[model samples]
Target chain A: MKQSTKYMMSDGLAFSEKRDLKRLQKKSKEGWHLFSFLPMGYNLQKGEPKELQYSVDYRHLQDGEDQEYFELFEMAGWNHVCSEVGIHFFVAPMGTQPIYTDVESQIDKVQRLSKNVYMTAVFFVLMTVVSYFVSELTTGIVSSIFHYILLASEVFTIPCLMMVASLLYRKWVKKS
Target chain B: MKSLEQLTDSVFYIMAALVQPKHGYAVMALVEKETGGEFTIGPATLYTIIKKLLNENLIFLHDESNPRRKVYALTEKGHHILVKDIERRKTMLSLAERELRGGNAE
Candidate 1:
């Protein structure tokens, strides 16, 4: 047992509040809520781990096959992280770890990507309008057909420009 | 002295414990004992440190211990790091003393 020490951005619950899987299983025999954090770890080895490695089924988590668990993991941080999960779960806070996951930032990044597209659309609209009016004024000519043609041209060019912009944006904002 | 950042502190502490050839459990006990019940590392924390140390070859798992238990022994690089860290601390203490005494001299 140790005195109160500040845990750095990590689970402090392991002190008194947590139990190892072995202990948890033992407690389950006596009927204590066997809360688990991370998976049971095996002793690691050198040169490509052979057996006794934790497998993460990325497909199940990524795909909507495990929808309920996915939502819970999303709203909270982890899946299979037991608390008062069976019946008294109604009273306890629905979420577990309050810490932000990479997914949270990933969602934000997606929003930013959409925002980039919207901004690009607005910019192209403004640019097209400016170009049409300026070209008309510069040559002192009035052609509604040309205005329509210019707008149609933008339909193709704008998408191409947006694609180029997206590539550039991705390069600039590649997740470090 | 500058307070060592959390990451650096953990690294330093784990490296310090690996000065002798000791297994995972033994290192944990030694660190806990050294800190006088001030600290107890979680399994995950210890695992990460062990992984990093092993990857860097600053510490290697010795085969002398029970095959089940991962015993660690420090390398030449690890000794250099420990020595460098001690020297830096000494320099920092002297600088601190000078600054503290210098303030009163004026």
Candidate 2:
């Protein structure tokens, strides 16, 4: 058997983490379990139908920390699914306590995610500005190169900015 | 994460449990058991708080021979902070109780 597989588009976690997790839960019930994360979406493999709840946590693990980190979640009944970048995904039976139980820690999770997003956004914004200035100051093939750079940077900068804005808004909402 | 100015319920429970030098999972189980399942700390939350406490010098690693189950215990500073938080909570409880008992009926 070639193994059944499919892809599902994500709505961008910074905008819709809750919606995405809920969708994963629904897919698990239909026997399509998430196999791994793909850029902009998920790669799912067919499996035994299950009633599971999914959650995402953001943290940078240091050397020798991953073992204890995963163990803690396992002991709490959450089975580790996969991790991409600093985002980790876990699943457990429905009604299991959520991974984040307090508002302070929940806010901290958002801040860690925001920190990563903010750095990327800053880089893209700088690229966009630098390329725009160089494209205007130079001419010929060199100008075209910077012009392309400006366009590419803008493309990335817009979404990065939106993600940062959304994350900051979430942090503010949680604080209030 | 910044040092906690006040212990949140989750942190309070974890701190109280760590007074006995327990591992991460042990802390979670103790909190759930002591609270009669009414209060519980999820694993991630417990881990985050434990790290914060460690960073703030409120807790220390009691044993790490078992890397997967490092035990933690409260530091002297941690005990002092915990005691202060308990006193603060006690004051709040007393105020609520007095009002509920019509100490200042109006």
Candidate 3:
């Protein structure tokens, strides 16, 4: 028999991880278990209806660290679901201890994510600025090419800056 | 996590468990058991704290024969820091206890 699957659009984790996790939990109750991550969403496969709690952790595992890192979670009652980029998803029975129990370490997790987002935002901002300058200082085709580049960069820059702003606000809220 | 002059509760608990040379899971189990479930450290937090302690030279890998379940123990520095934190906690506890008891006596 063919399997049933569906795609759920994410609101961009930088903006809505908690909402995504809650949605995942709700989907699990409806027999749609998260199968894997999509570029901008989740691929869920229909399965047994089970109530579960989902948690996400961000870590850049080094060589030879995956085994130990995963084993620890498994032993602690969280079963690994799927990982994409540095984001790991896990599911356990409801009321399982959260992946982060302390504010200091939770802040560390946010900072790690913030660092990556900040870098991307800065890169796009630079690209936008450079292209703007080139487009202004040149003429004809070269200027037009830079103008297009400038437009693309600006397109990326807006969302990236918004993400960066949210991240900064998150860090500030956590610190205070 | 950055090395802080003061150990957070999670760090302090993990370090206390490492005084016996336990693996990551063991530390979690021990803390949960000892605290009667009053305190627990999640796996990611445990792993992060373990890495931070190792970086600060507060903990040392005691055994890695299994690779996947490497054991850790408190270093001399870790022991010293834990001892100091215990003293600090004791002071806090005694002050609260004395005040509470005096109020009750009244």
Docking class of 3: medium
Off by over 4 Å in 1: A1-176, B1-7, B102-106
lDDT of 2: 0.92
The DockQ score of candidate 1 comes to 0.01
TM-score of 2: 0.96
lDDT on C-alpha atoms for all candidate structures: 0.46, 0.92, 0.91
List, for all models, the DockQ compared with the true complex: 0.01, 0.80, 0.77
In the range B45-69, model 3's lDDT, one tens digit per residue, is 9988988898999999898888789
DockQ of 3: 0.77
TM-score per model for chain B alone? 0.77, 0.94, 0.92
Ranking by DockQ: 2, 3, 1
Candidate achieving higher lDDT, 1 or 3: 3
Residue A145 C-alpha lDDT in model 2: 100
Q: What is the lDDT of residue A70 in candidate 1?
A: 32
2 or 3, which is superior by DockQ? 2
Leading candidate by lDDT: 2
**Residue-wise C-alpha lDDT for candidate 1, range A6-108, written one tens digit per residue:** 2112121112112332333333343333223332221111222111111111111223323333332333223333322111010012223222222322323
Q: Return the TM-score for each candidate structure.
A: 0.38, 0.96, 0.95
A best-first ranking of the candidates according to their lDDT comes to 2, 3, 1
